[model samples]
Target: MNKKFDILAIGAHPDDVELGCGGTLAKLISEGKTCAILDLTRGELGTRGTDQTRKEEATDAAKILGIAERENLGLKDGFLVNSEEYQLEIVRMIRKYRPEIVLANAIDDRHPDHAKAAKLVSDSCFLAGLRKIETSMDGINQEVWRPKQIFHYIQWKNIVPEFVIDISEYLDVKLKACAAYKTQFYDPDSKEPVTPIATKDFFESLTYRAQDLGRLSGVAYAEGFTSEKLVAMKNFDGIVL
Candidate 1:
């Protein structure tokens, strides 16, 4: 197997990618589509675990999900901005990975960083295609590269999804990947102070949410996503869910 990836999922913090689209990613990788993850921050501000622990957990989750690569940009936790500096950094990654499709954070979510990171990634995808942008790494100019599509994964909010991938068979895989972050999700044994996502109800809601979307789309389980531009297909038959 090659080390390069076909899809690169980006999130503002660790575990965001898994929570949002871990099943979809696992499903793709199962079919031999290479996958990678790029986390903008180490989630240092998280209530449960330290940055180092989160990084290690992310690594474990990546292995479980079979991702080709996982990287953290080390951006300041809870304080990332959409500036030229940040945009260029994202652009460089986009070019480096050269993914065919880019999965990014939701456009609107409970966390402010999600939406901001989504825009930053979306803009970088466009900027990466511009030869005049003049991006360089290690003193070598980079070639312009843009992903064919950018899909915004749904998270924390119930906005209507443009499309949904049936993840019924991969649900267990997704749950395991999410559970790798023991300090973040529901865990009765944990002594750490609980947060909204750390509650048992929140964990149950995550499953029900996928089921609800699946019910609407006539699937057993599915992950939803939104598209900034109108998505098209060869014909109606090409539509799935």
Candidate 2:
């Protein structure tokens, strides 16, 4: 199998990626960049929908965004920890994908698992580059691979983005992808018990949050992210919005 991807995004759960970088991923895919999602958990503890339903929803959302691949790690929801076992799992994936850039869950968030998963992925990225910490898959020896950069997407909390991407052209497409998870998001007809994120306000907030970020960046719509290291651009011409 080819061990390469333009981008690999890791989130604590299925919908987290859709809520955070759906527009960015859509734009990249439209530009012919290969992208994939690696959800740490199946979101089994969510208030709405079973793990099976969420898997289907995530599949539909990935198709809507035209992503090249989507997969879940099957970690226990709400119980993700920064441990050796988890780090090894992530390291294996990092080597498997060999992405140039990785987008991970926020460093801090309302969901505790998000932060834990972020640290695990970040650590695994560094470990993946070390020839000593070996990791493999499918009985085959995997090459040590590390992404050039890792950017953490902002969600649930406003941590002041290190940078925001102008995704104005793909904002509507992002909403379409998010709405693909009908079993998890706002669905008035669904009889499932509502969670904090299942309310109508949650859906509206997705739009307003992007709008707010866009207003600051002087774009119609944008997505925010915080990076541990500042971005080094080869040329500044026309890149900043």
Candidate 3:
């Protein structure tokens, strides 16, 4: 996967991206743009499933999304920290993929790791551009690289978005990708331990939230994001009617 990516979505856990911005990703891929996902952790601490189970689920989700690549860093779950070690690990991926846009975890969320991972990725994207800060992978030196934009997807919180992507057509595809994580989401028959996300209500919120965002933004369904820097549209032609 040496080819540069159009977008790279980073998450605190295996299923975070699926829950957050899967619709936008699906829409982008359908438009012929290349995308990738980087899970900062294997979601090892989730009550409903094992790390291995989550990994398999992540694979299924990635396949459903039709992303170019899905990689996990195997970082400690539930204990994410904004430190040099973590930042450098993410820096390597940023330089390796050289994506144009980066979608990251929410700036603030119900889980502390979400916010921490958000900051870690934000800083790494900046550090990856520093020519002096050296990093090597597979015994080869990596060239400095940085994404043109960083956007944090809305998670458990409704954090007012800087913008929204009209994903009305791809909402079904996103739901399908999320359903791939069987053990993590709503399942009436399975006897998995009830986690905050495993509830039926949580499953339904996925649709309502997107619908609400779309309603406010004059679309049928949409995914909202907060941009670190102002995004400029080349012209009025890009605006949704």
Candidate 4:
């Protein structure tokens, strides 16, 4: 697609974007912002689902979130490394999308891949802006483009947030999108191997965590993000009381 996006959310695995920022994404799309999701890997190493299953679930979740586009980089799961090769691949996507903001994996999380992907995406966002660092797509040289801001969505850890977006009305949308990953979540009927996220408690944490953040922020529900740079607002009027 040739259309520029307002935001691009990149995740290490298929469900990362959905669990971390689905509510914010739904809210953004409802407000008419163009958004896309890029999965760094298909989550092949996960206990419960096959790569193909995750891919299908991701597609369904993308549709539920009203994403403009979704693409996978085919990176190796569990063995994710912040290498130049991976960074270049991400740089290519950054130049292609030309997003104003980038939502990436948490800086550090319970999953090792999460931290690695965080660095990979953050570095690629910088490298993508350097005209000398060349990349091409579809046999055409891509333009050098950089996002104005990069934010890290909270994942498995209860890390403090730099900011929280009010997603009171969009929380249901987020939960439903996450539920699309039936094979990966708390599906009691599935005879698949149990994992940390396959438990009922894990499913409940998705809602309670958002609720706790909302309680702290005085919103009914919200998604939290951490940024490398300070977030500045044009005026205090935009701040939720």
Candidate 5:
């Protein structure tokens, strides 16, 4: 599909987006803005789930978030690097989707791949705008496109947010979306070995974290984001008091 998206969220692993900005995405989609997700890896190396299970879970999460489309780059899990080849692949998706805004992985996180994917996606966003950087899809040359803004979502770390999106109405949707990754999350009866994210505490932390961000922002629930460049607002009217 050649349809343009209002925003595109890219993550190093399948559940990263869901953990990071699923609430914001659900809020945006509910407001009629189209969004898509691009997963850099299938989370093949995740402790609790296989690649096939993650893929299925991702699809299910996308539906919950009302994503227009979801794609996996099939990049190696846990081995992401900011290489030209990998950057070009990301560039192609940027050009193809032509999104005005791009949501990306946290700059630094517990997982090294998260930081690596952040740099990879950020570089690709810049390179995608250069006319000389040629890229093609489906035997057709893609047009040069660059997102106007790139916002990194909070993940793992309690990095201070540049801004927060009120997601009180969509928090339930976000939780449901996250729950799609059954194997990756807390499963009381599972035989899989426990991982960092597979504990009951991690599952409950999702709600509490959002609630904490909301408390700081004076909202019932919220999601946080950090921008590489200063954010500009048209006016003070949109600011939530």
Candidate 6:
């Protein structure tokens, strides 16, 4: 696989990435870095959207974020497990994309699938680097590949972030990307069953949450994430002043 990505954002569902780290992704893509999205499921179990609609919505969201590529692993929604079968599927994607950085789901969240997918993706990243764990795609053998680092995005739970990325200029883009999932989020006109995220307040919370994180970190808006391992900085040159 010659298509290498600078970052691969993995989520349990279609909208999880948009909710958790859309602005951060948009910022990276704007800077000319290639990014991709790996959705573990089609979100078929979501209350308001069908699998077909979520797929369409995901496509629109990917376009809004200027993603280099997007893929769905077709895993069963709401039944995710950290099994070898699942890990091998993820390993194939990791080897295919060869991302240097990976953005994963929160360590713990309101949705059980979020936490399940987090561990699944994290373990797969390590497994992908092992030469013995072989994976193939489209009849081609894959080389071992591992991300240099992983950062878990904040989700439904307010688990404190280890670091925050300033996204003051990209918050609107983030909101837009999340909004692309019309059925999954707020819409007064929709007659479909109202879900937790479909409320007007939940829609507003997106902005406020980013603003709150930004306030704490001294930026207008930001996205928070926790590193899986301790990160070392070579110098203070890249530190935000």
Tell me the number of clashing residue pairs for each predicted model: 0, 0, 0, 0, 0, 0
Please tell me which model should have the higher lDDT, number 1 or number 5: 5
Error of 2 at 156 (Å): 0.8
In terms of lDDT, model 1 sits at 0.91
Q: Residues 1-241, candidate 6, lDDT per residue (tens digit)?
A: 4478899999999999999999999999999999999999999998897999999999999999999899999999999999999999999999999999999999999999999999999999999999998778998999999999999999999999999999999999999999999999989999999888999999999999999998998889989999999989999896578
TM-score of 3: 0.98
Candidate 1 per-residue C-alpha lDDT over 145-187 given as tens digits, one digit per residue, 9 for 90 to 100 = 9888999999898989999998988888888999999889999
lDDT measured at residue 210 in model 2 versus the true structure, 0 to 100: 95
Query: Where is model 2 poorest over a 10-residue stretch in terms of lDDT?
Result: 232-241
lDDT of 3 by residue, 1-241 (tens): 3359999999999989999999999999999999999999989989998999999999999999999899999999999998999999999999889999999999999999999999999999999999999998888899999899999999999899999999999999999999999999999998878888989999999999999999999999999999998889889997888
Residue pairs with backbone atoms closer than 3 Å in model 3 (clashes): none
Could you give candidate 5's per-residue lDDT for residues 49-86 as a string of tens digits?
A: 89999999999999989998999999999999999999
TM-score of each: 0.95, 0.97, 0.98, 0.98, 0.98, 0.98
The lowest-lDDT stretch of 10 consecutive residues in candidate 5 is 1-10
- TM-score of model number 4: 0.98
- Runs of candidate 6 with Cα error greater than 4 angstroms are none
> How well does candidate 4 score on lDDT at residue 184?
94
lDDT of 2: 0.91
Candidate 6 residue 222 Cα shift, in angstroms, is 0.5
Report the lDDT of model 3 for residue 173: 91
- C-alpha lDDT values of all predictions: 0.91, 0.91, 0.94, 0.94, 0.94, 0.94
What are the runs in model 3 whose C-alpha is more than 4 Å off? none
Instruction: State residue 228's C-alpha deviation in candidate 1, in Å.
Output: 1.3
Judge candidate 4 at residue 176 and give its lDDT: 99
Lowest summed lDDT window (length 10), candidate 6: 232-241
lDDT of 4 by residue, 59-96 (tens): 99999999999999999999999899999999999988
lDDT (C-alpha) at residue 39 in model 3: 98
